[model samples]
Target chain A: MNDKKTTHFGFQEVPVEEKAERVAEVFHSVAAKYDVMNDLMSGGIHRLWKRFTIEASGVRAGHKVLDIAGGTGDLSYQFAKLVGSNGQVVLADINASMLGVGRDRLTDRGIAGNINFAQCDAQFLPFPDNTFDCITIAFGLRNVTDKDMALRSMLRVLKPGGRLLVLEFSKPQSEILSKIYDTYSFKVLPFMGKLVTNDAESYRYLAESIRMHPDQQTLKEMMDTAGFVRTEFHNMTGGIVALHKGIKP
Target chain B: MALFMTSTLTIAALASAEKMLNAALRYDPATRIGLAQLEGKILAVQITAPALQFFIMPMDDELRLMGNWDGDVDTRITGSLLALAQLSQTEIHNLKDSGVTVMGDLSLLADLQRLVKNLDIDWEEMLSQFTGDIVGHQTAQMIRAKFGWAKDRAQSAQRLTSEFLTEELKALPSKPELEDFYRQVDDLRLAVDRAAARVETIINRKNIKEKSNP
Candidate 1:
C-alpha cells in the first residue's frame, strides 16, 4: 500500500515530491529550442499574446518587476526596457537550463544593467516582502506543482496594490474550436516537436498538462483564495489561452 | 471577452505599425537619433470621429505603441483623423483654427513636429542592402528625376489652367482686378454715407423754419 501524497505529472499521477523534478527535466530537454518551438507550434501567435501581456502590465519607469518562469527572457527583456536605468527586473526560473538560456539571450541582445537572472522557484521566491510592483508568469503557472503555494509566494513578494498577471492555456469557449484544438494538440504538436527538437514525449506532456490545468474561472478563484483582490481574466484566441490578473491588496 | 478581441486586435495592429515605422526609421539615421532624445516620453492621441485613443512611447531608436497606458502622458492631442493629420504638417499657430486641441508639454509637440518635418529617408542606402550599391544608386536617381519631372509638369499645368480661365476666357477675375473691384465698392459706400449726412442737415433746417413761422 502506497501512502505518499500524489500530484499530476501530465496524465499520470506521481509522488508530489517528484513532480518538480519531472517538470524540470522536461524544460531542460527543450530549453535550447524552446523559443523556436514556441514560434512554430503557435504559428507565431505567442509573440502577439506576449505583446498583449506587456501592454496590460502597466509597467513604467522606476518600477521593480519580477518575471517568474521567464524562459528565454521574453517578458524580462521588455520589462528591463520599460523600467529604464533606475528600475530593475528580475527574471526567475526554477529550471537552470531555461534560466541559463534566458540570461544568454538577453545579454546577447544588449539588455543588461537593469535586469537580473535568478534560478529560483515560484513556490519559494528569495526576495524580501513587498519588493516587486508587478509580477508575471507567462505560460508557466500550469507547470507549477503547487499553484496555490506559488500564488501565495508571489503575493508575499509583491508590494501593496501590486498586480500579478498569469498567462496560460485554458479551456476553449467554443465546442468546435475545442475539438479542433484537441486534435491539433494531440496530433500535430508532438509531430512537430519530434521533427524539430526530436522530443515528442515532452510535447505530449505539454498537451496533457494543459488539459489538467485549471480552467479560467477556477484559476481566478484560486488567486482570490490566495488573498488577491480584484481578480479578473481575459480570454485570447477564442479562450485557447487566458490571462488572469489579480491585485495584492 | 469583447475586451479580449479589442485589446488583441489593437496590440497586433500596434505591433505591425511599430515594425513598419522602425524599418522606415532605419534608413533615416537622423530621425532615429532624434527619436532617441524623446525616449520615455508618452504621447496620447485621441481621435474624436473614430472614438479611439492610443499611446505612443519612444524607447531607444524604436517606438512602442500601446492601446492602453496607465502612467501619465507627456502630451495629449485630441482631434478628428483629418484634423490630426493636418496638425502634424501644419504650423503650431494654425492649430487653433485647425480644430485640434493640444494639452500638456507644448514643447514636446513642437519637437515632434520639427522631427517629422526634417525626416529624410535614404532609399538608396536601404536598397543597397538588397541590390548592389551602383544599381541602387542609379535606381534611386531615376526615381528622383521622375518625381521631379512629374512635379514640374503638374505645377506648369496648374498655372496654364489658371491663366486660360482668367486672362483668355475671362471666366474669373485676376488678383489685381479683384482688388480694384473691392476698392471701388469701398469708395461707393463712403459716397453714399456723405450724401445721407447732407440730406439730414437740410431736413433739420427746414423743420426749424416751419417751427418759427408757427
Candidate 2:
C-alpha cells in the first residue's frame, strides 16, 4: 500500500526522497567540527589517504578538477595548487553549511584566484557535460542516497580520458582487522564524536552508512555499470579504506 | 596487506622527508628562491638496490615528494643509494664515473647541484625563533666552532691512519709506491707485446720457407 521507494539511511529504511534531506541534516550538524573529527577519528591517516589520491589523480597545470562533496576543502586546496594559475578547481557540496565552511576555510588560507565553490548535489551535478578532467569524492560518497546515479552523473561531467577517484570506507581484507575496525567504528567513533562534536548519532549513522555502502569489488562493478572504463581500486589501511579509480573512455 | 603496508609506509616516509626538507629550506631563503625557479620540473630518483623510485616536484619554494607519479619527469637518476648520495654531494660532471646514470635535462641537475652547494642556513636566526636571540647566537657559534674543530681532527686522524698503515705497519702501498708499481706493470706489458710480435714474424718466415722448399 505504501510503495514510494525506500533506501537505507544508516541501518534504518527511509523513503528515497527523504534520504538526501536526512543526510544533509547530519552534515549540517557536523560541518563546524568536521575537520577536527576526521583527524581525531582516523588518527591523521586520512591525510595520507588523500595524498595517495592526489598522486593517482595525475592532475597537472591547466586542468579542471571538481571535488564533489568537497567538505572542508581538503582536496580542493591541493588541487588548486597543483592546477596553477591557469587551471580551475570547483569545490561542490550538497550541504550549504559544509560548502560555507569549506569556502571560508579556503578563502582564509588565501587559496583564491583559481578556485570556485558550488553548492550542488552529486546525483545531479550542475556542470555541463565533459567538463572536468578529474573528479574526487572523499569520504562523502557513502552518504549519497543514490550512489549509482551519482557515479553516472560524475561520468557525464568527466571529459574523455578523465578520471574519477572515490575514497571511502570498504570491507577489510583480514578477518582480525575487520573485527577490530568494526569495534572501533561502532564503539570508539561514536564515543569520540560525542566527546568532540557532541553528536553521537551522526557518527553512528556514519558507521552504519559505511557498512551499507558497497564493497571494493562491488563498487568497481558499479563503476563499470556506470559506463566507465579501466575501473580499478587500491585498498589503503588494510582495506579499511579503498580508493576506487575509473577513467572515462 | 603487503600493498597496504608498502603504500602507507612509503607515503608516510615521503611526507616526513618533504616536511623536514621544507623546514630546513625555510631557513635558507636563497635555496627557496632557487627552488621556486625550478617549479613545474620533476626529478625522478631510482634506487636500484632497494628497487624503489620516487618523484620530486618543486613548487612554490618547496619540494613535493611523491611515492608514485605518472607524468613526464624532467630528469631521472638511477643508481644505488650510496652512488646517488655521492652524486648529490659531488660535482655532477666529476661524478660521471660514480656509477650513477643520469638521463634527461643535464642542466636541471646542474642547477640543482649548484643550489645545494650554495645552501647557507642561518642557524642562529632559525634558533632565535624558538630560544631567545642571545642563547641562539651562542649556541650557533658553539656549533660552528665545534664543527670546524671536528673537521680538522678528522683530517688529521685520516692522515695519521694512512701513515700508520703504509709506513709504520707496512700493510698497504703508499701513493708514490703504488704509482711506481703501475708504471713498472705498464712497461712490462709493452715489452711482452714487442716480444710476441717478433716471435710471430719469425714463425711466419719459417712457414714461408717450408712452403717454398716443399
Candidate 3:
C-alpha cells in the first residue's frame, strides 16, 4: 500500500491513474470478439465456471443487486431473474465497451424492465451505502487496478446481512493440472487469440492477470479484512475458479 | 437453515424454480444463485439483446456445435455448459426437456462486442467495413506499449482494410509518384484501423440504446 501509487497493467508496473484508460482500450479493441475467444480458448469451460458462480449467488425476489465489473452481465442477468420484477439489478463497469456488451445481452432476452446499466469504477461505486442486497464481481476483479479498494467499496455498499460473491480464476488445486493449464494458457491461448480475436496481446494479458490475482485463501482474508462475516471459499474444478462468499456483518 | 430465508420448499416456488432451472440448463446459469434450486432447481443466466444471435441460439444439433467442445467421446457426456437443458444429467433434466429457449441477459454490450470482435473475425470484418480506418497502427501500438503491452503482445493484430486508403489515394497530387502513393496506401491502412474502431463504438452505443428500449 504505497501512497506514491504504483499498479500493474497486466504484467507491467506503472502509475495507477493511467491503468483504467489502458484497460479500457484493451476491452474496446476486443469487445466484439470477446465471447468467441472465450469459447475457442477455454473450450467452453468458462461457461461452467460462471455457472458455478451464479449457482452460489443466493439472490431472490425484491432484492436489489449490484453487479460490479459486470462484463457482458453474465452474473447480473442471473441476479435479475432471481430478484424478479420487484427487484432491480444494476450492471456497472468501468469500461463502457464491456458494459455495452452486457446491456445488449440482457435486453435481448425480454428482460429490460428489471435491469439497469451504469458506467462506474469499482473503487467508487455510484450508489449510496447499504443499498444493495447483494453485489457480485464475476471475473471482473482481476482487471481492476486496486483490488483492495474495490473490495472495500463493495463492503461499504452492502446492506446489513447482504452477501458479496467474488467469482474469479484462482490457483489450481493440483500441480499437474497447474502445469497443464499453464502450458495451455501461456501457449495455446495466445495463438487462439491471434486466430480468433486477432488480439494475442489481450489474451496474453488475461492469462497473465489470472496468474497475478490473489488465491482463494488470500482473497478470503481480504474479505474478512473488509469487515465481512462468515467469509468462506468454494473451490470449483480443482480450484481453477473459486467462489468467495461473505456476509456484511 | 442459515437464518437467510432458508425455508422448506413449497409447490409454487418449486414450480418457479423448475422453470428457472430449465432456463439455466439451456443457457448460462446465474452465479451464487441459491434461489434457483431450493428444490435442486437452477436459474439460467439471462442475456438480453436486440440481436440475440450471440445468446439465443436454437438448441438443436447446431446448438451443440457452437461450442465445438471436443470432450471425451467414449465417456457418457452430460452438462458440457454448452449442452441444451434437455440433455443434462442433473435431476433437473425433466425441467430441461420442456424446451425454454430464452438465453441469459448480458450487461455491457461493449465487452461482448469486444469479445465478439476478438473471437469472431466475421463480426470484426463487418465492423471494419462499417467504420473507416484512420488511427495509425504505429501510433496506437506506441500508446499500448507505453502502458506495457509486451513487445510480443503488442505485435499481434488483425489485418483490416481502410476505407480511407482508396479515398485518400484519389485525393493524391495530380503528378504523384509511385512512392507517394505507396506512402498514401500506408496512410490508408491506418485510416481503416480508425474506421474499424468507429464501427465498434457505434455498435456499443447502439446496443446500449437497445438495452433501454421497451
True-contact fraction per candidate equals 0.58, 0.58, 0.00
Please provide, for model 2 over B26-89, each residue's C-alpha lDDT reduced to its tens digit, 9 standing for 90 to 100: 7889888999999999998887855667788988888898887767989998997556644554
Whole-model Cα lDDT of every candidate shown, in order? 0.86, 0.88, 0.63
Residue A181's lDDT within candidate 2 is 93
Tens-digit lDDT string for candidate 1 (B8-73): 655666676566657777788887788899998989988786466778888887777777776689
Quality class of the docking in candidate 1, CAPRI style: acceptable
TM-score of chain A of each: 0.99, 0.99, 0.95
Q: What is the lDDT of residue B43 in candidate 3?
A: 24
- What is the full ranking by lDDT, best candidate first? 2, 1, 3
User: Can you write out model 3's per-residue Cα lDDT over A26-121, one digit (the tens) per residue?
Assistant: 888888888888777767766656654554565656889998888887778767766778899999988888888888888987667889899999
Error of 1 at A199 (Å): 0.7
lDDT of 2 by residue, A1-249 (tens): 887899999999999999999999999999999999999999999999999999888899999999999999999999999999999999999999999999999999989999999999999999999999999999989989889999999999999999999999999999999999999999999999999999999999999999999999999999999999988899998999999989999
Residues A1-249 of candidate 1 have per-residue lDDT tens digits of: 879999999999999999999999899999999999999989998988888888778898899999999999999999999999999999999999999999999999999899998999899999999999999999999899999999999999999999999999999999999999999999999999999899999999999999999999999999999999989999888899999999999
User: How good is the docking of model 2, by CAPRI class?
Assistant: acceptable
B-chain TM-score, every candidate? 0.53, 0.53, 0.18
Q: Rank the candidates by TM-score, best first.
A: 2, 1, 3
Of 2 and 3, the candidate ranking higher by lDDT: 2
